[model samples]
Target: MTADRQAVTQVLSGLAEIRPWYQDLYRHLHANPELSMAEYATAERIATELRNTPGADDAEITTGIGNTGVTAVLRNGDEPCVLIRADMDALPVREATGLGYASTATGTSPDGSSVPVMHACGHDSHVTCQLAAYRLLAAHRDTWSGTLIALFQPAEEAFDGAQTMADDNLADRIPKPDVALAQHVLPGAAGTVMISPGPIMAACDDMFITVHGKGGHGSAPHETVDPVVLTAAIVMRLQTIVSREVDPNDVAVITVGRMEAGTKNNIIPDTAEIELTVRTYDERVRTRTLDAIHRVVRAEALASGAPEPEIRFLSRLPLTTNDPAVTEQVRQAFTAHFGEDRTRPKEREAGSEDFGIIPDLFGTPYCYWCFGAHDPAGWYAAEAAGTAGSDFPDCHSPYFAPLLDALDTGVEAMVVAALAWLGTDRA
Candidate 1:
């Protein structure tokens, strides 16, 4: 075996011993989730865990970054520095997995409404794996030499955590890393890794639109402009943008996730609201798509003799493009450690991430990868039966549940990837 592979194996030798602790941690986190930017208790728990770790006594721990983010830096020598990130926020999804440890927690959402919160996106697994990886690296310090920065970020579900960290002077607060690394638990065969060189995830843009109209009784629709009809027309026209305006070769998705209008059946509402999300891979395509939306909304309103609709941006996320050199190093390490069968190339995903913001802030290169947490048997069965889409529950779903076997895989993936930059010295 190569020196790097040997080093990785040595560092992970104690994984079996530490597995139980992290698995329990996963359950605890899974049952009690915190919403975006409100992860106060979660942040404290992470700091406490790092402090109590065997060899992490000297690690510098920082808390309350970006409201509720945490970072622990463990240094073995004056070698390369690698920053590994994991988000700690949960979504406003109620638990439906029916697991004994399923979340029954509730938190106030950004909209000031009480909503059930759950780790529907597998972030609980992300945190557990990261903590386990950090503990292993610390316990087996002789196997590698470098500064390892374990960052637990907050508010990722709101798509602003990375930016929030940067705005709070994350670079000045911690040692700048030569490269950044992050991983996500996805729906695939357990113990497998998914990686790509560039643009693994798309850019996201959300907009809230309000269409104005004159309100009147429902029975007298002829006397006033009907915003419901105008909005319907706008929605239909928006569909044509992808089919007619954008090139069929490029990828772009426009989803109208929310619409609000009249409250009573007998009264026509004065205005209608629409909230949509736009996903795109290319900057030009994003711009073109957004411009088309503005034009279409205005044109449809004008055609209906209604007032121009007001459009406001809800959130924006840049495309996640992995550095080729960084990705190759991690990919080779994964192949060497996990073997060819488990280390596989991943296709471009339409989902969006804000991780790019942090590396961009540090002006350094980075790579983010995914690992399978779904049951291998079930995933393969779905694939074989051509029912993968219908059979497998994806991230952000209340029913989304990652198998426990993936916890070890996630730790191994992070350690292997971090060691690619940290060191290859024998223990």
Candidate 2:
């Protein structure tokens, strides 16, 4: 075996002892999920666990930096520092997995409605993996020669945690990371690790369009300007942005997620509104898509004799671009540790991660990998066998649940990646 591979194996072997603890923690967090910007208790629990772990006394916990986020520093050597991030916030999804540790925890949302909260997105497993990495790195500090910064971030579900932490100077507080790494649990072929070189996640932008027309009785067809009709026309035309305008090879998606209009059946409403989400990988394509949407909405409204439509673009999650050189380095490390067969090329994912925001501020190398969580014998047998949960719950579904057993490989992979980047002791 190669030196790095052997070293990684040694660290992974050491991690085996904590496998049960990782599962227990995963269950606890899964049973008590918290929402974005409301991860206070979650943060405290994580801090407490880290503080109690061996060699983690030097770990410094800073709370409330980015709303409800937690930042911990684990120092070992005097060499260059690296940052490893794991999101800690859960989704507002109701638990339907029917597991013993399923979340019964409920909270009043910003709208004041009670909703079941669960770690359906696998943040619990993410937390466990990060902690496992922290412990392994800390225990074997003698084998590595650099500082490791662990981020227990909140609000990743809403794509705001990384920005929140960055706004609070979390990056500046520590030595600007030489490399930034994170892992996402995916329900896919078991024991496979996937990575893409650049623009793994698309840029996500929310859109709102309002169409206005004169209100009149339904019977007076000629007297009333119909905005609902205009809105419908615009929606259909918006599809052309991707079909006709953008290159077929360049992926772009424009989806109208919602629409609202007149309430009464007998009258034409004065206004109608449409909500849309636009996703794209290339900047030029994104700009063209947005322009096409605006043009379609305005022209359709004008052609239908309606007032100028109002267009609003809300929160934008920038396209996540991984540095090529850094990505190659990670690929090489994964090949060294997991073998070339286990580490394969991954296609670009349509989803967006707020972690993309990190590269905007610093030049540090940043990449995220997919951690296998699917169980072959279905949920029951997988749970009974203590295998990793499948990607089945889907990301934002109410039934989202992750298999905690898969996190063992996640932790080991992260440690290997960190050590490889730091140029620590070769396997």
Candidate 3:
């Protein structure tokens, strides 16, 4: 390592040290989880933590930027500004993990429905680590140059907080960042960081398809067109889009998550609605997949002699692609700290992230990584038994629980990434 590299890593390692105090903060946030855009208490707590941290004076902060979002700004020297982000919303899943910190809290969802809340997605860890990273970077401002813009984004689960920040002029408020960085905790062995050069996460589209038909008694099959049968045909045909239409090499998924048609066995409803989530890494595949779905739904409805079906696209998330050179630099820096074994390369996942909004909107290059949130031995063992991730709790599950041991690696990785982007030259 060069003298400057050594000096920066040592100083940053010391600064990013996980303190005993963060445990309670993490647990408190986990226990009192809030839903997207409704993170009133969660937002307040994060803002309070940064405001009262030891080096609070160096950072100028704001709240309510994107409706319960908080951004803290810290400037060190003349180097290029670096943006670091963490999501701040919890999912509507009730806690089944049985941890002491598992959320019993229920909150209002975006649609104004009362739902149980839990940090099943591990946003709690993301927020806690960002708080730690920001405090340390601010405390040791003399170690590196450039500005630090840390955003505690709300509504990631609702799929729009990062975009909301952009709409509210997040990039214009602070000078646009030269490099953007964010990390997520996924179900894997602890202490490892998964990095991919381009298309780390899939592009996601949420849509709903409605099948129209005449309502009639179940006993009188000839009198009415059965919407339930039409719904079944549509669902089955959707399965062919990936296996038959899209190239085998291209990654894509079409999931029919929700289906509703009849309230009673004897009654054939007038309409059946199906909610779908589509994932793809390539735009062409995404387009072809969505188009195929529309065609299948429409053709099936028409063949059934039913009225025209309705299709509505709910949300679209851009694909997340890491900047090649920047990713390699961060990978090398992580390998130095985690060794070659822990800092391994990863492939593009079918999962999606609205977090990609940061780089897309700011026009800044970004690198996203997944840090494992489960014990290695158990995770591997679980995978062996035909279970999820070697038994690691999957995100968004009522039973999801992130291993706390990964927190330190996440904090340090963010610190190392920021230091690298901010450069090693000291003032």
* Candidate 1 per-residue lDDT over residues 221-292, each given as its tens digit: 998899999999989899999999999899899999988899999888899999999999999999999999
| Candidate 3 regions with alpha-carbon error over 4 angstroms | 13-18, 56-58, 96-100, 109-115, 214-229, 262-269, 301-307, 376-388
Candidate 3 lDDT, 316-380, residue by residue in tens: 99998899988988888788778898887777788778887877787889999888888878776
Q: All candidates' TM-scores?
A: 0.90, 0.90, 0.88
Residue-level error in angstroms, candidate 3, position 189: 2.7
Global fold similarity of model 1 (TM-score): 0.90
In order of lDDT, best first, we have 1, 3, 2
What RMSD does each model have against the real structure? 2.7, 3.7, 3.1
Least well predicted 10-residue stretch by lDDT in candidate 3 = 7-16
The local lDDT score (0 to 100) that residue 16 gets in candidate 2 is 71
RMSD of 2: 3.7
Q: Per-residue lDDT for 102 in model 2?
A: 85
- Using lDDT as the yardstick, the better of models 1 and 2 is 1
